[model samples]
Structures are given as C-alpha cells and as structure tokens.
Target: MNPQIPDGLRELLALAAGAGQAPWRTLLRPGDWLLLLCCAALVAASYPLLWRGGVADRAIVKRDGRLVTELALNVARKYEVTGAIGTTVIEVQPGRARVLSDPGPRQYCVQQGWLSRANAVAICAPNHVTLQLAGRGGAHADYDTINY
Candidate 1:
C-alpha cells in the first residue's frame, strides 16, 4: 500500500528544501563541532592505556592438564616441565616468560616468544603443556576469552 503524507507537512518540507526560501545554513553550530572534536580527541588519547593488558608478575605452568609450578617474574630462570610427549623448557625473566624449547613437533609454543602481559598464554598441544602469565591478582576477571 502507498503511504500518503499530509499536505501541510509536505509544503513545510518543500519550503525547508529551498524550493521557496533562501538556501539553508548547516544545522551544526561552531560550538557543536568543537564539542565533537574534543570528545574524539579524548577517546583517541585514552583508548590505548585502558585496553593494553596489565603487568604480569608470575608464570603458571601446567602439564597434562594439571598445575605444575608457578614461577615468579622478579628473577630470571629456566624451568623444565615433563609433559605427555616429552620435556618442555620454559625461561622466565623480569615480568615475562616464554617457551624456550618444546618437544612438540610444530614448536608453536616456543615460537610464541615472550609473554609480558597478564593473561598471556602459550600452549604446546603435542606435549600437553601450557604456560600462562598472570598479575598479582591473577587473570583478569572481565575477559571472556583471551588469544595469544
């Protein structure tokens, strides 16, 4: 069905479209544009600080789906974990940890490199080993899923 506009409303629309009056000025005033620019600038400056992950204070190691050990991030050291397949070597330094060597054929976890931020994780699927970084309070409660 065709919808019809009332005649008075149609005439008002036509006049506002410059059909029978001077050309219209923009609806936005200078103050409106200034407010919009300020809001955009604030968001741009704050986005990175708020979204970047927290500082990691320790590394949690797991093997065969069980907790193996927790290494403090304040001291540099290397650890070995026995997993389903073979041994996986982990290295830890101030505020970071990474899989230094893994028996997994793909070596994906070793290639993951340093995990400095809270909630960072590396998994050696073939060896059944996992390394996770956490802050003093542990993993962020707000995140639903984190990918490394």
Candidate 2:
C-alpha cells in the first residue's frame, strides 16, 4: 500500500513549520481589522433597532374593533372585557398584563401568558378582542422585532 499526504495538508504543514511571525499578525491586515470593527459597529447599531424593550405602563384593551378601555399596569387589577363571543378577563400587575380567561374555544390568548414589554399583544380572534401593552407614548411606541 502507498500512503500520500494531500496537497492542501502538505501546504498547511509547510506554512505552519516555516512561518516566523504569529499567524494572526500575518493573517489579519489593517483592512481586516477595519472590516472587523465596522462589522462590530454594525452589530452594535442593530441592537437598538432590532431589540426594543420600551417601558410599558398601561394596557389597551379593544373589543369588536372598537377601543374598549385602558388599564394601568402599575396598579394590579382584573377587568372583564365583553367581546363578540363572551367576556375575557384581563389581569394586570406591576408592568405586566395577561388574559386570565377567554370564552374562545381555542385559548390562544389565555395561553399567551404574561406580557410586560411595550407593543406586546395578545389577540383573541374568536372573541374579537385584543390586549396590547403600551408605554407612555401609548400604542405609538416603537415596536420590537417580534411585533414588527
């Protein structure tokens, strides 16, 4: 049997054995560093645009396509909103809100759990109800990636 090293492996071995300077110093040029810095800056800039965690102070509850009422999240309370199908119990705590109960067959809104972030929404399509968290700007606050 005959054994032979591949051309790429042979070249790699030669480079590793003969190189005097450090591999990073030789591999990374000024332009490479500048590119890396630019990429890092782009990533840093995208954070604010992509991840929006606004301060939510209230929740806006809508039913049957009309504005029903606004509930303050700071004061914990439960409000029953009448929708097309039935009543939906909305529970609000400090900086958060959720659908405690819904008359819809599929409890998608109830299963959504707590919503504490601005622009976070829980929609009960069957009941035509929507519960959305809002900041001081109301529902006009900048939306997060999920909402956008």
Candidate 3:
C-alpha cells in the first residue's frame, strides 16, 4: 500500500540524476574544443582539395612540347596524337581524360591514370606527349599559355 519510494532508493535516484549532469560547456571538456576545431579545420581545408569540373571542361593534348589538340570534356571521344616518338591514344569523357595507350617505353602516361580535375596532367616522357585538364574560368582562361 506504500506508494512512496524507499528513503535509500530515493536518495540513490537523486544522486544518480546529478552524477551524470553538467553544464553544456563544462561537459564538452577542455581538449574537446581543440579536437572539434581540428575536425572543423580539416573539413574546411578539404573543400578546395575537392575537384570541381564546371569550367575545367577541356582536355588538351600536347605533342613534342606543343599543344596538338584541345577537346571538350563533355564530348566522349578517343583522340590519337602523333608525336616525335609515336602515336598516343587519349580517351576523353565528361569531365575526365586519360591515355588508353601511348608509344612510350615505360607507358608511364597510361600508368598515371585519369585526369578529371582542373590543371591535372598526364605526361608520357618517352612519347613526348602531355595531356592537361583546362577550365574556361578566369584562372584557367582558355589555355593561358600552357606551354605543353
């Protein structure tokens, strides 16, 4: 018939309620803000590292230190560039470019893999071929004297 909680149980409950409770700022602790700040800084710094292809829409292929071709990235196609060494096969996709094959000794350009980010380059030293990603924005500015 006793509806009231026992004295010891009530006291235990009161202590339990306050034991884990603290001010919001105090609960965060001293080093937690530093960790939070570092995490926030990391996320902020990663924004620029992310590749954006809005204006970086062209794949330019250079042969023998000269610009041989510039292809729009939106158009999917395969381009062959003949240089002093030999022909290089460049495959272009939307916002990306890569060398399918090249007449180089080590095939380094093919190993360099795809170029989707602005200002990224794949160079085949033996074949004298270089492919670079370009943007139409102010910084990129339509070739901007890429000089191979």
For 24-82, candidate 3 gives per-residue lDDT tens digits of: 78778779999999999999988864544334688888887788988999988999988
Lowest summed lDDT across 10 adjacent residues in model 2 is found at 138-147
Which pairs clash (backbone N, Cα, C closer than 3 Å) in model 3?
A: none
Backbone Cα, N, C clashes tallied per candidate: 0, 0, 0
Pick by TM-score: 2 or 3, better one: 2
Show pairs that collide, candidate 2: none
Evaluated against the true structure, the overall lDDT of model 3 is 0.80
Residue range 3-105, candidate 2, lDDT tens digits:
8788789979988788666666788889999999999999998897455548788888998778899998889899998888889999999989999999999
User: Which residue pairs collide in model 1, if any?
Assistant: none
Cα lDDT, model 1, residue 145? 18
Query: Model 3, clash count?
Result: 0
Ranking by lDDT: 2, 1, 3
Off by over 4 Å in 1: 1-53, 141-148
**TM values, all candidates:** 0.62, 0.61, 0.57
